[model samples]
Target: MPDTEGHPEVNEIELVDVFAALADPLRLKVVRDLLAEPDGVERHCTSFGLPVSKSTRSHHFKVLREAGLIRQVDRGNSRMATLRRADLETRFPGLLSSLS
Candidate 1:
């Protein structure tokens, strides 16, 4: 299980890793949904309504977190996720806009 602190630092984020993480449609949708939310809003992992198993959804979140695209933390029994918007913008300008 990975914690919020376990994610790669913004400076340590690599383009290839981010690209690979977003290569999956599910993973890309997760990021896009987060981006659509207002700033500072953290959504629970299960709220995505994805057509996949719990474990598969967890895997997608893991990939995004490891790629420095999202920050996730345990909130009660649910895992909350927020798009690392500022961090991503800092590391790769115009990237998020292009995705939207």
Candidate 2:
């Protein structure tokens, strides 16, 4: 399958990586915000209101994507993000709920 924004393919998803990606305060908040959205909510990066530099924000998003916590796709002139909810839920049942 084609890679989606560098996220781990569904088969490659790992619990350890997901946990590590969520360990950071900022990243955890990012995930939380995404979770708060209605299912399939595609958000622009800046809409998160994260208190980080542009480069730092990009890095955080990269970490999350690499860890399979989120999937990003190009939308028009900007990139958008959405939580990888189903993949995460299947890999570790009820884990996302526990984070809230």
Candidate 3:
């Protein structure tokens, strides 16, 4: 399976990694907020208004992306993130729904 933006393939996504990533309250909030958005909607990172420093926010995003919980891409000067809802559902059914 091909990887996109360092995201794990659906088959490679592990429940442990996802749980670890979601363990962080800030990261979990990011996931929950993304879940609240309509499917396929992407939000700029800055839109979240995370209380952490810019680098800290970036770190949080990287963790989420690497955990296969989100798909992120660079857009101009900012990064945009979208929850990997379908992939999550395919890999672990009802996972995302339970988080919402």
Candidate 4:
């Protein structure tokens, strides 16, 4: 579903998957921090005092990304996460708005 600009169109992403991803307490905290962050000032992986080890933290982030709950991009040595607020709002209507 690439557009004329050669970018794959983001289709109608599922509500269940996104909600399920955020259902985890750790994942919910991750998304909440992302929502409050300013542009280019995303929360990093090391900042969260999650009880899990490094590998487990890696797994949660991966699930969040795959669920379309967050948009991730490499920033130097770490990956930055931004909550997909606008997209999720459109799909579920008032989902992030009410929660925020």
Best-matching candidate per lDDT: 3
TM-score winner, 3 or 4: 3
lDDT of 2 at 97: 95
| Deviation in Å, model 1, residue 64 alpha carbon | 0.4
lDDT of 2 at 80: 95
Clashing pairs in 2: none
The lDDT of each candidate is 0.90, 0.89, 0.91, 0.71
User: TM-score for each prediction?
Assistant: 0.93, 0.93, 0.93, 0.78
lDDT of 1 by residue, 11-69 (tens): 88899999999999999998899889998799999888999998888888888999999
Q: What is the clash count for each candidate, in the order shown?
A: 0, 0, 0, 0
- What TM-score number comes out for model 1? 0.93
Candidate ranking under lDDT, highest first, comes to: 3, 1, 2, 4
Error of 2 at 56 (Å): 0.5
Q: How well is each residue in 1-100 modelled by candidate 4, as lDDT tens digits?
A: 4333222224646778778888899988887777677644566776767889999998898878777776666789987667766677666787776556
Clashing pairs in 4: none
Determine which window of 10 residues in candidate 2 has minimal summed lDDT: 1-10
Superposition error at 11 for model 3 (Å): 0.9
Model 4 gets an lDDT of 0.71
> Which pairs of residues collide in candidate 3?
none
Worst 10 residues of 1 by lDDT: 1-10
Question: For model 3, how does the per-residue alpha-carbon lDDT over 1-100 read when each residue is reduced to its tens digit?
Answer: 4375687888888899999999999999999999889999999998888999999999999999988999998888778999999999999999888987
The local lDDT score (0 to 100) that residue 23 gets in candidate 2 is: 87
